[model samples]
Target chain A: MTRFGRMWVMTGLLLGLAMPAGPARAQEHAPAAAAQAGGHEIDIQHHIGDSHEIEIPFVGIYELPRFAPIHVGGLVIDLSPTKHLVFMLLSALIVALVFVLSARSIAGAQARGRPATGFAGAMEATTLWIRQEVILPTIGPHGDKFVPYLLTLFFFILAMNLFGLVPGGATATGNITVTAALAIIAFLVIEVTGMRTLGPKGYLGTIFYRPHGLPGGPGGAVLKVVLLAVLTPIELIGKLAKPFALAVRLFANMTSGHVLVLALIGLTFLFQSYTVGLGASVLATGVLLLELFVAFLQAYVFTLLTSVFIGLMREAH
Target chain B: MVHALMLALQEEHTSGPLTVEGGLMLWTVFIFILLLLVLKRFAWPAILGAVEAREQALEQQLAEAERSRTEAAALLAEHKRLVADAKGQAHGIIVDARQLAEKERAAAMEKTKQEQQEFLARARREIDVERDRAIADLRREAVDLSLAAASKLIGERVGTDTDRKLVMDYLATLDGGR
Candidate 1:
């Protein structure tokens, strides 16, 4: 922020601090304080963290019904519904519904010999762009086969990310586990396709490939084998690191935006002045909107990297 | 899920944002799998098929349109060629007709000129014949008169055949010389 903006914020916060309310502040700030003793850090975590109950700001908290009531030696499976799970499921259903409706209309258009319209047209444009520009360019020659998977990944992640910005929603992608699972799926697809294309021996050789031409001798053969041994782990790590970075990049981006938004809101509570809170909220709105853009950008990045990884794995050179 | 960690967990160890609980992970994976299965089975095939079909249709339509254009151009060129051929034939026919008429006209004029020369020669022949006949008659009369006059002058009549023949012969010689 500029100096003028900062002064304005501080003035608002000072005015907010002049207000008086004891019990509500103490009660609200209690859970927040458990994370960070004093400061805006506590509320930020409370906002993004997964919880047993769905907390709606205007509406009261609604506790999820628990499943698997039996406890196995005081260590339950903990396989009950969560706020994250609800929102995640909701996001999935929404994505499915949108695509299903669009697909049906498109299919109908094809049947009747008419042009695609409205949402179907939009979906068509996006699908075609991904096929031609994103997937085809990256995977090369017959890269079109990967379109379904990439489309699923792109739209799925995009929907989930946008869902997080809802009034009473949690970011499913913000969770490490979610990002990790997605990355794991992408990794499996990459490896399987690589193995399918290159064959087992070629795939293994690619992992340990040495560019230098080996001299014709027993000693040179031994040296080449040794060099391969030395370089194999590095190559393997490099392969694994692509997916790892993909997961972290998405998780960090999604989580950071929520954190920023929360912290800004928490600034109002920190000052205990409604005027300062208002000013902070006004400021946070900009970032909140930016989060929407970041959500899309991060989803594109994840899908793009996955494409690049798949491309890298499929091509021997 | 109602994990005891939320309300009564330690702030220090649990403070890290990267920590993963088993429950959330399981749910996420399960939900994702369910989503993939549902989409792959129901949604993807339909959408991808439609888009592919539409694209192919468009390509086929475009190709057909191009073929039609080429056929039209060829037909136009053929029509133009036939028109040009007909025009050339008509021009040739006109030239032949004019040449034939010119030949007939020249033949008729030559025949008329020959007939005029023949008629003039015939008239000259008839005139020459008539003039010769008149001269013969005049010579006869002159011979008879000359004989009569001579007899009168001599106060004698020459009744001998030889005398008449001699005078006639002398007249014939004068006529031939003239």
Candidate 2:
């Protein structure tokens, strides 16, 4: 067999052997933790709500909360250091690094065959794929201009989503506030691109233009105006609904996947049975794999739909 | 008690909402706009220029390939025409050589037949001359024998005078009778 074929075969065999052994090991070691627990079980804190109480050390305080709020000019801000913000900044840095590296690669013409490498190649492939497959096809000519924004949105959401999967990690996307911010950005881009391409008058016309076919006559113009007026609230609501939907969809999917994995793992503690723990362990592993797929899928879906919305706004009709 | 608990929860929920009220939104908007501007100004033009350059290069290569293909096809056609012309010339030369050989052979046969006829005529003329000479010699011999027999009966050999006299007398008698 060819080298690649043999490598694939070896990989498949390794996975086949490893998959069963993992569950078996979990099954074998199930009751040891329960025996150690005796009457008192070890409880790990999983705080879902916003407010969390924490104990401070060294300063001889009776009680202390995990987080505090600071007010600045009537604005109350949470002073707690959250990992989500770190992940966001990291994502931005990663994007900057990718662009800088790719730019450097092309800067010197003498460097042949050095387009992109490793992470850079992956980032470029993703950007180019989205531009060619999703954006350009939907947005038509001059669609390449929006590639950076689209790529940024995709990687940002992806990094945030994957960051939540790490141990003790909180999902920024799970918070409605973060998702709403992203959606609002998309909303702004769409409106701005539309206005820039079609002018303000054309933009308003896009919202109001209706094909003529109704039961009324000259009165129909008034009816059209009335209908448009009535539909204005609905259109505005729809615009808000888009970001809300984006936020909720990502937050719900990520939260639910994590919850399921946690629940499966929790089952072993609730019931001190080896077979049940083994089954749950296997199921949780499978769910983890699925979560990986969901991470990428949600990111792609968000970026693809956002680009589509932008394209729709940019369209003439 | 329930009221106090509700108030506590409400305070908890409402405490931080105002602190970052417009600040976060403003920052997000500012950062996003900055990102868009920077990307548009710096990164976008370079990326697009590279893509366009690559596309143009590909198009140029394709055009060159097509031109070369056309040139090759034309060359092949020219070569085929030349080969066909050469084949036709070769065929014509073979035909001309065959025709020339046939004409030369016919002329040679005609010349050879003329020479053979001349040789046969010369041989027949020589044979006729030889036969006439032999006949004259035979006639002279007979006359000599007749003269010898007559001299033997007269018991004397005939001399040259006698022979001439006999020939004259014979001739004179023939003229008188005439």
Candidate 3:
């Protein structure tokens, strides 16, 4: 094998060997926690879902701080931080710090008539790629104005998704609530752009589509009514469906990868065999690698789909 | 493996993965908006501006390079033209000098030939005049000696103008008869 191939195999082997250790450690306290919860069954939900507790491998699980529920007129809002919420916050903070610093370095270098080097260079390249290749092309002309928003989404989601792969880390992007919020924002941007680009009368055409070259007078009127009656609801559904797809696609993809990895890791404990543990570890390693890819992929997909939706809205006839 | 995955997926849950926590959603919206605003203000403009400035600088540099290359080429062409002109002028100067030298040589040769001819003609004229004078002197002496010899033979004085004229006439007749 070539050097890179050999190195790759070595990494896979190491990852495989290291995979079972975390689950094994957690398994030490699994029975006690399961018993306390009134069951002795494995709860995959505890791994993928939000929790009041945060687990860090090699260190014990710690309960997050709880805040009092805020009362509105008839609604109670619990702003208490959960495991996913904490990870989300961490992802946001990390993105902010890294980008702010990278930007400073880039600007400093540029002022001296040079391109940024090192970590800032890498960050610049990535941001430029997303801006030039993904956002600019997908969202068409005048798309540069939206680069900051889309770039933030991509990096933030990417960080959240990648955090899941870390030992004892949570996947905040896997939560439907988070994905839904992102999708809602994307939907607002798309519709608002459509309204701004097309104005009131033109914007209405997207939902109440009327085909050209229809008969004049009464027949055209009847045809227009018929078209509106049939296609308007479909068009409205399509508009809602775009954001819905964006939300569900990201949530499911991010969640499924973790679920598979969790299930594979669970296999070792279920069988209680060293041979099985090794096999399960190898499998989990493969799934973990795939999860890593999915992390980047889902981020890219979310950004790409949002841009595409915006483009569609911008030019809607 | 599929059965295992299905069994795992079928496992019971307290709160399903699909459930959207309202507070979490609120937090996500707040965080996403905040991040967008922060990054937009601090990061995106600076990074993008820097990149664009760099691109413009590179483009300007490339254009300048092209202009410099064109200028160099033009300068090279002009230098070649000047060298060619200088070479042509030098050749013209050399050709003119040779032609002038040939004309001077021809003129000098003609002058020398004329001077030699004039000297020979003058010498010939002087020789002819000298010969004529000498002949006249010899004739006069011969006539005087003849006169003296005749007087001795006759035993009479014949040295006079009249005698000379008669003798000269006789001599002329005698010469005519011969």
Candidate 4:
């Protein structure tokens, strides 16, 4: 994974800086001139939104192949890969390459009685710290088995988030569609792991009884059953709400940062001056850095919350 | 047609950022699962195994070092005890030898002192006997000379027992009177 991660990162960064006057150049005149900007509002929308073409305003805009009209037994399904989808593929490839490569280094270093140095060592430290400190502590010792799943989520989201900060790359997490899919996976894991660990009855017991068991005597059992039935809908809502929050939190955080940066850039044309453009770039720089921080922070929060949910389900109560 | 165009433009402007296309979500799921499978199969096991193996090796090395140190300490204590024991034994033997030497010297001195006393007594007895013999010889010679002088004065050869007796008796009486 490290190999692909390095390749993608280098490519992304180089394409970003070297392409000067590229996407950033797309905000020309008043941004209201080309795609119908609403005093910078429309421009901000277009900038963050997914597009069917790779647009580098100064050089070219290449329209992607459209497959929305494909017919399969009279049922048409659109399966074309958009800009975000391409980056999404790159993100996956990056994740696969980084982990696979680093795993090889770690395995090899074991023979020499040490760890891999430089980049590989840093990667190893992160993996270990997250597994031991974040996942295992929350999920318990048995949580060791789930380390790969949790780690993959972290690095994948992290890669995509950071990639979005690069000049031309679309932040996949900024799209609600992408964030919703990730949240669905988390929800499945939480519910499925709960079922598997607690065994169907024990799983329902979480929504009903307090982990120990149901009440003892007849009157008490009746009272408890009444409480469980009364609160079951609320418990069900709580279960669904956790993943929803996870998805929205990330989607909002990433989308807001990009919107802010685009707005700062759009301010240049709003005032119609080169000096304003320079000043706006300076201000945008600060927000750009904040977006970078948010990228890492949001990824961490998503992974941590997912782990916490899994832990709550796995452990006794 | 112009109103339709106007509506299309309005929709285009609003449709981009917030739209959650079903197709993109499906694509994302497919991509994420592909990543998960690839990582799980190709990467995770090796990395986790290497980490555990390294930990075990480090722990084993530390334990071996501790054992060796303990054994070395025990051997050092044993060596020190042996050296102390040998020194004490040697000192005891030296003291015993010195005491034996002192006793032998004192016995030899006592024997030599008794032999010297006996020799002195014997020498004193022999010296007294020699002195007595010398005095007797001198007296006899004096008696003989006195007898010869009397005979010459009388111009006669006298050999009688009575005459000899008288001479002896006269000498004895003269000595008693003096």
TM-score of chain A of each: 0.82, 0.73, 0.89, 0.82
Ranking by TM-score: 1, 3, 4, 2
**Residue clash pairs of candidate 1:** A12-A276, A16-A272, A16-A273, A82-B1
* TM-score of structure candidate 2: 0.67
Q: After superposing candidate 2, which stretches have Cα over 4 Å from the reference? A: A1-81, A105-110, A212-240, A268-278, B1-27, B30-59, B114-178
Interface-residue RMSD per candidate? 5.3, 6.8, 2.2, 5.1
Candidate that would win on lDDT? 3
Q: TM-score for each prediction? A: 0.79, 0.67, 0.77, 0.73
**Native RMSD of candidate 3 (Å):** 6.6
Task: Name the TM-score of chain A in model 1.
Answer: 0.82
- Candidate 3 lDDT (Cα, 0 to 1): 0.81
RMSD of 4: 8.5
lDDT of 1 at A136: 77
Model 1 regions lying over 4 Å from their true place: A1-42, A65-78, A266-283, B1-16, B124-178
**Per-residue lDDT of model 3, residues A1-317, tens digit only:** 24522443344346636653234423433454445544333456677778888877547779989889788777777789998899999999999999999999999898887899999999999999999999999899988878888999999999999888765777899899899999999999999889899999889988888787888999889988998899899999999999999999999999888777666655554664557756866777677777888889999999999999999898887
Each prediction's Cα RMSD?
Answer: 7.3, 10.4, 6.6, 8.5
Instruction: Give the clashing residue pairs of candidate 3, or none.
Output: none
lDDT scores of the candidates, listed in order = 0.73, 0.60, 0.81, 0.74
> Which ranking of candidates, highest DockQ first?
3, 4, 1, 2
Cα lDDT of model 4 by residue, B129-160, tens digit? 77667655655665667667777788776536
